[model samples]
Target: MLLGYRASEQYNSYYKPVYYRLAESGGQERLRELLSQTPSIQIYDTIESQLSELAKINNPQRQLTPEEYKVEVARYLDGKDPDEYGVWVYYPWSQKLVHLLDEEEFVQVRTSRNLYKIKPEELETLKTKKLGIIGLSVGQSIAMTIATERICGELYLADFDTVELCNMNRLSNCNVYNLGASKAVITAQKIAELDPFLKVTCFTDGITADNIDTFLGTGSSQLNILIEECDSIDVKILSRVKARAKGIPVVMDTNDRGMLDVERFDLEPERPLFHGNLNEEGIDLTKLKDLTSQEKLPMLDAMVNLSALSDRMKYSLSEMGKTINTWPQLASSVVLGGAMVTDTCRRILLSETTSSGRYYIDFKELIK
Candidate 1:
């Protein structure tokens, strides 16, 4: 019911450190180790073998028409081994060959129900758009959401930080096994396993002034949308400056009170960066670093009207590393943020009625 994964897949989708049995490191070694313990490994001779079993289930009466059988048989007669044609990935604990579905077919099947609502034309428009996500804490959920929904052609993921124990509170993908792994690398690997064809570019060192151009696709096609989520206020401002200069739209989710921001530099080339929050020409963004809770508060106030935020958020900000080392974010807010950003991105890229603005999914307001 949830993106083709059942509740049983919860651990695999969110909790476990994602592992595969293929070309990735430790892949062959892990497979050999597991296979040594088990008596046999499972494999379907071809995709046709699996299809035949399904056909039997679909028609135990054996009443399939001659035309149906011919069409079905012709489906497999493309002169290539069905299992061999596509990339293969084995999820942890799976006991058989897991041939990834064809890229186009996978997208179509996974997002089939999202049609008409998202609109077929809108989905098509999203197909070729390039998206970028910086910082993989909240960004990780956003990346996974975008991947599952097949919203963009390529996803540029930027995150320099490695997993830390504190990160586990909100990063559903974090686990003890990958405690110190690079966030960008781990995310890229997960995306590849999810949709082999979902193009991914990782910026393990995170975006900087020198590399911002490359991350924004300067030498190549510019990104259609940027989902900025980095901790460094410097990169945050710098990225938008580049985005504004290049005429690319930007998106950001604060993961507090379900806050999401949209800046349409593509629509209005001269639009001020961050809606004038960084308008002071003298402000040296390069001097900025990952802000402490107190340092972030005043900057946040300028970016957002703090009065509009929930009481809980206002209370948390007052503590500033005393009661809280940083901002408090919940899984619910992070998940909601991912959906909000992607939906906003879709609306913008499709040239819909959606305009550049800020919106919220305030739980306090909603619950009341």
Candidate 2:
């Protein structure tokens, strides 16, 4: 016969069970065994116990609830010294915590917090706004920033490219495991993991001229912001034109030494200066499309001449290929630029004016 009994320790209330087994031979032996088993049952107390019983009682580790975490974040943001409360150890990035320990580095954190405090309305506005981001290289940074801020109810991610090894340097939410996955698909999966309720629409093929109308003009297109980070300058311009035409403000962040060229084409007709110049009266997109590469060069030269753009500029354009490569200089620039873009977008959404224009931040000057 075998029996088990559940038992708990009086000190900690931790539960475990004790087991007993009995064996039988002959009838007389079995009766003797049964009688002896009760008395001879070696109560081998096989119970496990923690070595540091006092520590276990005093400091039991438990995860902070979401609300508790949010409250902590808010308090930290409000300039409360987290280290004094001993809660700063839990959050490594807490500026208040860092400041309390290192007074020399405290000023920078305080300044950053001051800037962040200026956009209180942005936090609320982003929760209800919708944004469409094309190209996942630099766009991933933008998406992550937006998601971190808890803004933007829905996000539409579009990219035709797959996660190549070269993209690892700049693209967030990309890993070796996602190397061959479509950028849009991987980004959507990552965003879903971050916030299950975030409405995400992924287009693996990306937005083309033919599908651009459907993407931005459909009944589902309620986007408040359109971010253009495509590899192709032509596509970037085209996407901006389309978004502007649809009355959605277009924001583009270029990695020109961590500088941002923000154009708010929130015009009634949503016309952008680039489109206005490119789509001039005599321009023929269809004719240019039909021409071969060899034939297109001469036509492009003629068009450049007709458009009155300088020969030097035209030569520079010819020398610069279409694909925007991510150099270390540009990668660093894009990150800084993305942060500025996020701040600017927040200001715009909140209807606050914090000076808007094509702002450039020279790293050399910044370092100096």
Candidate 3:
């Protein structure tokens, strides 16, 4: 499920020239770091091949057997505890071994693209922040993308549903084995597999009115950013209410035409909820509970924008349970949504950009 490795930071200069000189000086240590990735030399096909690679580090010259090779390799590990071999990390749908880089090295290797956009000097700021993601549908991808890039040092995940056969359409990492497993458990496990260093707190009970305050951080610590993807309408509005009071930003992806909603409660304490789209359409938010499939259509359209909604979505709503049992969701749209929201969260968190109101990430608009 995950590939684990030990990592250490090998560079720290603010400038490239000085950093390169420092990295060059620690060249042998870097090589040892790279070689320490595998379980042991036994995993190698032949002892000669293992020693051949390690021999490059030998100052003079010496012959050694498979047994002696282990001792020689340990010398360059720089007193790293022999007890820990590698740290396991799971990145979304697939898994693989990557260098166990130090905090700086990991941040550098993982988020190079985030540089310039997120100034190198400002990288550590992201790690100091905490982000919370609720609902595992699109939120799972958002969580993974955040972890894959080491966006935040600590994360809080909340999801109550379980992986069902129907969920496979969008929840890609979950397979039969994960069926019946709570979404929060699944997401937390996935996050653990990806980067053990990332601190995660799971709310398996889901975010409810009762616990929303704690979720928002009742203690001294408050969430820096909140990504809400819950299905309960009450929780949706209530969460925003709490977020506004706490001055935390909220982001949500609808997975339709790249539709995303940004509520900058942190910036505007009195901002209207969901841009007041529901009220504008004469839609009653209080009547959302227990509505029939067809009855819910109008509210959905208003929440996501009616006129701009895709023809396919309009048709799906018209049919309700007739043609499709539920709203159609393609994996492409979900993943695109995950990436969009995560990128937006990154820009907003880093102060590199600001987002609010409603925006369409429709590919149709981008290409033509």
Q: How accurate is candidate 3 locally (lDDT)?
A: 0.68
**Candidate 3 structure quality by residue, lDDT tens digits, 1-368:** 23452111111101011011113456445445544653342211232333334443342366666667666657634456421222212232222333243344434545666657667666788888889998887888888888887667888888877677888888877666667667766776677555556778888788876788888895447898999887766567667878988999999998889999999988888887788665534434455565685675555665677778888888987786687777778888988887888788888887876668888878988988
What is the lDDT, from 0 to 100, of the residue 190 in candidate 1? 70
How much is the lDDT of residue 292 in candidate 1? 65
Residue 122 in candidate 2, Cα distance off native in Å: 4.6
Residues 143-254 of candidate 1 have per-residue lDDT tens digits of: 9888877788888988888777788888776566666677877677677656767788888788888788988886358898889987677777888888988988889998
Q: Which residue runs of candidate 2 sit more than 4 Å off their true CA positions? A: 1-122, 218-220, 268-271, 275-279, 285-330, 354-356
Rank order by TM-score, top first? 1, 3, 2
Best by lDDT: 1
**Alpha-carbon shift of residue 62 in model 2 (angstroms):** 19
RMSD to native for every prediction?
8.0, 18.3, 11.5
The best candidate by TM-score is 1
The lDDT of each candidate is 0.72, 0.53, 0.68
Query: Which of 1 and 3 is the better model by lDDT?
Result: 1
Q: Rank the candidates by lDDT, best first.
A: 1, 3, 2
